[model samples]
Structure formats: structure tokens, C-alpha cells
Target: MTVIVRDLRPDVPADTEGFARVRRLALPYILFTSDSVRHNAVHVPAEARYRPLVAEEDGEVIGTAQVHLAHDSAEPGQGLVNIYVRPDRTGRGAGGLLLRAAEEHLTAEGATRLFTWVLDEPAHRAFAERHGYRSSRSSHFLRLDLAGAALPALPETPAGVELRTAADFADDPRPLFELDTETMRDEPGDIDVEYTDYDAWIEQYWKHPLLDRDLTVAACVDGRPVAFSVAYTDGGGRYSTAMTGTARAHRGRGLAKLAKTHSLHRARAAGLTEAFTGNDAGNDPMIAINKWLGYEICATEVRHVRELG
Candidate 1:
């Protein structure tokens, strides 16, 4: 069978479904949906030059790659590509073809360096290394069984604090954006990103298809959000915490943990069964909080960087 790598056609429903299906199968711990796939394809900023490539074999999409520049990062010429092939179709040359296309595209777009996240497995690491990528930081994919897991009770709000939902900010979400921007400064990552575009943030985050407004909990200090746990549900039984962070000023007050706890309780009550979240391996605080909430390490992946000659 001949495998051909080509750009994913977002207007085609089957292409989106196939991409999501392969991603779900290759990385079960993380959540993927057809809507998310389409959203990224359509809403990606022009500066990022984001492209989703699919490897088609025998009329089936067996592999996928998301290639893009780090547009939001202060540093330029930093590109990234994540490739995933169906578990059963690994040896059919699909991955290599997808990687080649992604690399060519990114290099043409002026990428001096590229990065990718590869699953922490023998074959996966081997593939990355063979492609000249060197290992860097690692992260863990965590899972919590919301159906049966016993989560911590939400602590009483401080005298000046209150618990609210992201839905409460329907009139305006600038506060949440400011809080997220501040919290992200402390988030462990290889890239340094500053979220300065409110319109871009709204399109990419606040209006995302998977964001569950009702289940997303926020800790407010006198009507200003200080901490929050952004929840995403796939309209099935799967719920994921997209982000849980506390503003620097609110650190050590356990507001993040409290917000996440409330979000989890509400998610389970709404019939979501599985909860998923990922953390940088070095983020002890978030890992500890997740562990406190009964989450376990389900899988791990390592970031790999390669210099383009």
C-alpha cells in the first residue's frame, strides 16, 4: 500500500473525523474530538502557519501531524510538529512521510529550530532520535476516574473570596485572560509565551468547542478572579482540565486546588466519568495537587528539539 502525506482538508468531515480517531487511538490518555480538530485548522493564526498533515494509505488516514510556529512566544523561528500514527500502522512508512512533510513546511516557513513531543516508549523515542531530535523536558499525562474517585471537598472560601464559574464572566472575560496570562508565566514549559491578544485568546480558548463553562470553576476575590480550573468536556463521559492555575499573588493559598476540586465535583455531577490532565514533569505543585485529587500517571511524553541546518 502506498502512503501519501497531504494537508488535511478541514472542510471535509471525514478528514477531521479520521484525524481525531487516529489521535485518540495513538494517545488515549489525552482527549481529542472532531470539533477540536476542525477548530484548530480553521482558527489558527496566520502568523503561526499551522498545518495539519495526514498520511493516507489505501484511502485511510493512518497518521497525522500538527506543524506550526510558536507565534505567541517572544522568541522567533521556533517551530513545532507533533506526529502520531495509528498503533497498528507504525511500520508502513506513514510516520516518516508525515514528518518529512511537516519538516519541509516548517523549514520553508523560516523555522530555525523545531520541537516535538514523543511518547515515552521505546519505539517512539527511537523514531524521534533517528530523525535527529534530542530529548529535553518530559511531561506526564494523568487520569482521574471521576465516576468512582473520591475527590477532596471544596474548602470554605476565604472571607474576601467567593467561588464562581467561568459562565459568570459571559459579559466579559478579560479578568480571566489577565489571570491566565499571569499564571502562565510560572507554568513550566520549554517556550516562553505571553498572551497579549485578547481577540486571539477569545477565539482560541474562551470560545473553544470543548470548554465547559458550567463545570469550569473560578476563585474570585471580591469579584475579581484570582484562580481557576478550566474544564473541557467532549459531550460524552470524558472531561479534561485544560488548565488549573493560581495567580502569583494567590499562590500558597490553595485556591487552585480548591477551584479544581469544585470543578471536579461539578463535572462528575454532570455525568462526566473520566478526567484527564497533563503536567510538566518538573511541576511538583500541580502534580501533588492532582495526586491529592486521586489522579494517577497514565502516560508520559518527552519533548525533543532539533536544530534545522
Candidate 2:
């Protein structure tokens, strides 16, 4: 059994399915489909130099890796390599092979800092540590039983507040972009991003295959978006809240929760069974909101960083 790591062939049907299978098995918290996988491999921004890799043992894929530079980050030379192997195939050396390939590619691309997410488990942490990666921040994957969880009732629109969907702004989504720009800046993360390229945002996010425009709820105050819950559905049973945020001024009004609750209810009505969301471990406010929505911390992953010479 020899393991070989190579670039993902989106055009090949089996490679797409194999890559999606490994990701789903290794990280069930996120939603993935063959289409989404293929789209991501092909539609990545040129500046990002995104490369999706798969570790194939003989003819079967056992692990996957997404390697890319943080092009949008305010700081350059930050590379990301998220590797996941099938739970059943852990001891087969596939992980080391994938990591080696990813690191070589990223270092060649001028990466000075490399970051990866390792599941917050003993074995995973040990593997990262052995690879010279040091733990930095952590994050949690939260799950909610959309069918069984009783979501909070939708709140009444305040005197000036209104609820709308992302699709409602199809004619003009700059407002949502502006809202995202403001809200995303507040999200806790390793890299600081400045969303100045509206066109890039549109191509990278607005036009993604999984973005459910109708289910993405937004809160408005006098026609301006103040809070929003971005939804992504796999067109199957699972739905994930890609992001839920409130503007700096709208922090305490509970509008972010309101938007999320409304989005979850809408998702449930649309026949989605399970919902998933993720938050930085230190982001207590968002975690509390997810708990209010009956989301339990299903899994946790810690950010591991290494300096790339």
C-alpha cells in the first residue's frame, strides 16, 4: 500500500467524489458536495493560488488538503494548509505525505507563516506538535438538530427595523457588502482582512454554489443592513450558518440572534434537517447565541502555526 499525494482533478468524477467523501468523513461539521468541491478547485481567485490536494493510497483517496496563500489578508506571506485524513486510515502515513506536499507548495509560493487547524484531540495535537506546529487559538464546531431543536420565535421588527433575505438585494447587494465589510472586521481570527474589493467578494462569496440566498437573513434599520446571518445549504439535508454578525452599533439589540433564528426556521421549513455553525473558542458572545439556539459544541479544532523558512 503506497500513498501518493497529488493535486485534485476536478474534471474527474471519481476524484471529486473521493475528495468530498474524505472531507465529509473527517470533518462532518461543514457541508460539501461534488459540485462545491469542483467549483472551489477551479474558481479560486488567481491571487490566492489555491491548490486542493488528495492523498491516494493505491487507487483510493485517504486524505485531502486545501493549500493556499491568504491573499486577502492585510499581512502577506501567510499560508493556510488544512489537511484531513479518513478516520479509519490515520496510521498509514498519508497525513505526513499530504503535509509534506502542501508545505513544499506553500513554501515555494513565498509563505513565511504557515497555519493549520488540528482537531482538539490528543492524537491530533500530538501529530501537529511533532510537525513543529505550535498551538495558537482554537475554534468550535457547533451543531443544532434543526428538526428537534425549538428555535427562538422570530422577534417583531422594531419601529425602524425590518428583515430581508440576501436575494431581496439581488438588484443591488452593495449594502450587504458594506454590512459584511463592517461585520466581518469584528470576527475573531488569525488574519486581519480588509474587504476593499467588492468585485472579488462577489466572485468569491456571492456567486458560490452553496450560498443559499433566500435563507440568508439580514436585519435592516431604515433600509440599511445592520445585522445578517449568511446561510449555506448543500441542497440536501444539512445547512450551515456561514456567518452571523451584527454591526458595531447594533451590538446589544439581539438583532444577530434574531436574524439567525429566522434563518434557521426558514431552513427547517425548507426541509433541512441539521444545522452547523462554528465560532472562535474565545468568541463568547457568538457561542452564547448559538447555545441559545440550542447548538451544542460538537467538535473543537485548534489553530496550529509554524514559521516557514
Candidate 3:
């Protein structure tokens, strides 16, 4: 079977559905939907040069790639490509062809370095190494059975603090944005992100297709958000924690833990069966919090990098 790689047609429902299907099968830890796929393809900032590609064989999409520059990072020339082929469609040259196209596009767009995440399996790691990518930091995908696990009781709202949902801030989300920006500064990651673009943030985050505002909990201090747990639900009894963070000023107060717990209780009440979240291997604080919430490590992925000459 001959396979060809080309840019994903965002306007085509079949292409979007196929892309989401591959992602859901290959990386079940994360939430993916056809609407989310189309949103990213259409709403990502132009400076990022985001290009979603698909590998088609006999009119069937067998692989997918999300290619983009690190536009919001202070460091320039850093590009990212995440390629995943259907679990049943491996060994068909689909992944390699997708990577080649992604690399050529990023390199032509001035990328000096490329990064990708490979599942912590021998074959996956071998593929990256064969492509000149070296292993770097790793992360863990965690899972919690909301339907069966006994979650911790919702913490009492500390004096002078109130717990609220993201929906409560519909009239004004700037506070949440500011809080998110502050917390992101300390998030464990390889890239130093420059997150000052509020408009871009709104399009990429606040308006995301999977965002479940009712399930997203935030801790407010005198009506200003200080910590939050962003929630994304797939409308299929699967919920994921997109991000959970506390502003630096509020660190050590357990506000993040409180917010996350509240979010979980609400998620369970809403009938979500499973909960998923990911954390960098080195993020001890968040890891501890997730553990306390009964999350267990389900899988691990290693980041691999290749420097383009």
C-alpha cells in the first residue's frame, strides 16, 4: 500500500475525524475531538506556522502530525512535531514520511532545533534515535477512576477565600488569564514561554472546544482568582485536567490542591468515569498532589530533541 503525507484539510469533517481518531487510539491519556482538531488548525496564531498533516493510504488516514514553531517561546528557531500512527497501521512508513514533511516545513520556516515526544517503549525510542533525536526529560500520564475511587472530601473554603467555577467568570476572564500567566512562569518545562498575548490566549484556551467550564474550579481571594484547575471533558464520561496551578504569591497555601479536589468532586458528580492528567517527571509538588488524589501512573513519554544543522 502506498502512503502519502499532506496537509490536513481543516474544512473537511472526515479529515478532522480521522485525525482525532488516530490521536485517541495512539494517546488515550489526552482528550481529542474533531472540533478540537479543527479549532487548532484554524485558530493557532499565524506566527506559530502551525501545520496539521495527515498520512493517507487508499483514502484512509493512517497517521497524523501536529507541526508548529515555538512562537510564544522567548527562544527562537525551536520547532515541535508530534506524529502518531494508528496502532494497527505501524511498519508502513507512515510515521517516517510524516516526520520528513514536518521537518522540511519547520526547517524552511527557520527552525534550528526540533522536539518530539515518544512513548517510553523500545520501538518508539528506537525510531527517534534513528532520526538523530536524543532523549531528554520525561513525563508521566496519570489516570484516576472517578467512578470507583473515593475522592477526598472537598476542603472548606479558607477564610477570605471562595471557590468558584470558570463559568462564574463568564463576564470577565481576565483574572483567570492573569492568574494562568503568573503560574505558567514557574511550570516545569523545557521551553521558556512568553505568554503576554491575551487575544491569542482567549482563542487557544478560553474558547477551546473541550473546556468544561462548570467542571473547572478556581480559588478566589476577595473575588480575584488565585489558583485554578482547568478541566476538559470529552462528553463521553472521560475528563482530563488540562492544567492546575497556583500563583507564586499563593504557593504553599494548598489552594491548588483545594481547587483540583473541588473540580474532581464536581466531575464525579457529573458522571465522568475516568480522569486523566500529565505531569513532568520532575514536578514533585504536582505529582504528590495527584497521588494524594489517587492518580496512578499509567504511561510515560520521553521528550526527544534533534538539532538541525
Candidate 4:
């Protein structure tokens, strides 16, 4: 069976469904949907040069890759290609074919370095090593049984800080955008990101179909958002924390913890029975915060980097 790589046809419902299916099977910890797949294909920034590729074997999508340049990074020519093959389809050449296609695309677009996330399994690591990629930092995917786990009680906010929902900013979400950008700058990752495009953020993040504005909790100081925990519901009783962070100036105030806890409580109250979140291994503070909230490590993935030169 010949495995051929090609760009995903967003207009084809079957293609999108297959792509999302492959991702779900390979990385079930994260949230993914057909709508989100198409949205990313259309809404990503032009500078990103994003390309969603799929490996087809006799018309079956067995592997997928999300390839794009790190446009928001301070450094230039930093690209990323996350490839995942269905667990049942491994041992075939689909993964290698997908990687080669993604690397060629990024290289043609002037990417000097390529980064990918590989599940922390021996087989996955061996595949990456065979391709000249070395392991870097690792991240943990944590899961909490909202139905059974006892969540910490919500803490009282200080006099100057107040808790608010993302819905409160329906009239204007610029403050939340600014706060997100500031916090993301300090996030631990292989590539640094800057969220400067408000319209793009709205199209790609705020307006996403899964984003639960009503459940997303934000900590406000004097009417300005300083920290927030963005929530996304899969409409299947599963809730995921898309992002949880505090602005640099607001760090050490426990505002991130406050926002996250509030969001979790709201999610549970709304009947979300399972909650999932991810944290970089080096982010001790966030890990501690999640642990305090009763989250346990469900899975781990390592970041792998390869130089094109």
C-alpha cells in the first residue's frame, strides 16, 4: 500500500472528520473537532504559512500534520510540524511520509528549525531519533474527575480584585486579548509567541465554537483583566482549560489560581464531569496550582526539535 501525503481539503467534510479522528486517536488528551480543524485552516495568520497535511493510504487518512511557521516568535525562521499517526496504523510508512512532506513545505517557506511534539513513549521517541530530532522539554496532560474529585473551595478575592466571566466582555474583549498576549509571552515552550492580532484572535480563539465564554473566569483589577482561565466545552460533558495565566504584573497575587478555580467550579456546576489541562514540565508554579486543584497526570509528551540545515 502506497502512502501519499497531501494538503487537507477543508471543503471535504470527510477529510476534516478523518483528520480530527486521527488526532483524537493519537492525542486524546487535547480537544479537537472538525469545526476547529477547518477554522484553523482558514483563520491562521498569513505569516504563519500554515499547512494541514494528511497521509492517505488507499483513501484512508492514517496520519496528519499541522505545519506552520512560528510567526509570532521574536526569532525568525522557527517552524513547527506536529505529526500523529493513528495508533492502529503505526509501523507503516505513513508517519515518515507525513514528516517528510511537512519538512519540505516548511523548508521551502524558509523555516530553519522545526519542532514537533511526540508522546513520551519509547516507540515515538525512537521514530523521532531516527529522523535526527532530539528530545527537549516535556509537558504533562492532567485530568480531573470533576464528578468525583473534590475541588478546592473558591478563595475570596482581595479588596482590589474581582472575579468576572468572559461573557462580561462581550461588548469588548480587547482587555482580555491584551492580558492573554502579555501572559503568553512568558509561557514555557520551544517557540515564543505574541498575540498581537486582535481580529485574528477573535476569529481563531474568542469566536471558536467550543469556547465557553460563560464558564471562562477572569480576574479583574480596577476593571482591567489581569488574569484569566479560558474554558472550552466539547458538548460531551468534557471541559478543557484552553489557557490559564496571569499578567506579569499580577503574578504572585494568586490571581491565576483564583481564576482557574472559579472557572472549574462554574464548569462543574454546569454539569461538566471531566476536566483536562496541560502544563509544561518546567512550569512548577502552574503544576503546583493544578495539583492543589486535584488534577492528576494523565499523559506526557516531549517536545522534539530538528534542524533543517
Predicted structure with the largest lDDT when compared to the true one: 3
**Of the candidates numbered 3 and 4, which has the greater TM-score value?**
3
CA lDDT of 232 in candidate 4?
A: 91
Tell me the alpha-carbon RMSD of every candidate: 0.8, 1.1, 0.7, 1.1
Q: Can you tell me which runs of candidate 4 are displaced by over 4 Å?
A: none
lDDT of 1: 0.93
What is candidate 4's TM-score against the reference? Answer: 0.97
User: TM-score ranking from best to worst?
Assistant: 3, 1, 4, 2
Taking all chains together, each candidate's TM-score versus the true structure is: 0.99, 0.97, 0.99, 0.97
Q: Write the per-residue lDDT of candidate 1 for residues 212-235, one digit (tens) a residue.
A: 999999999989999999999998
Q: What C-alpha lDDT do the candidate models reach, one value each? A: 0.93, 0.92, 0.95, 0.92
Estimate candidate 2's alpha-carbon lDDT, on a 0 to 1 scale. 0.92
Q: Which digits, one per residue and each the tens of the lDDT, describe model 4 over residues 193-227? A: 89888998998888888899999999999999999
Q: How accurate is candidate 4 locally (lDDT)?
A: 0.92
Clashing pairs in 3: none
After TM-score superposition, the amount by which residue 110's alpha carbon in candidate 3 deviates from its true location, in angstroms, is 0.4
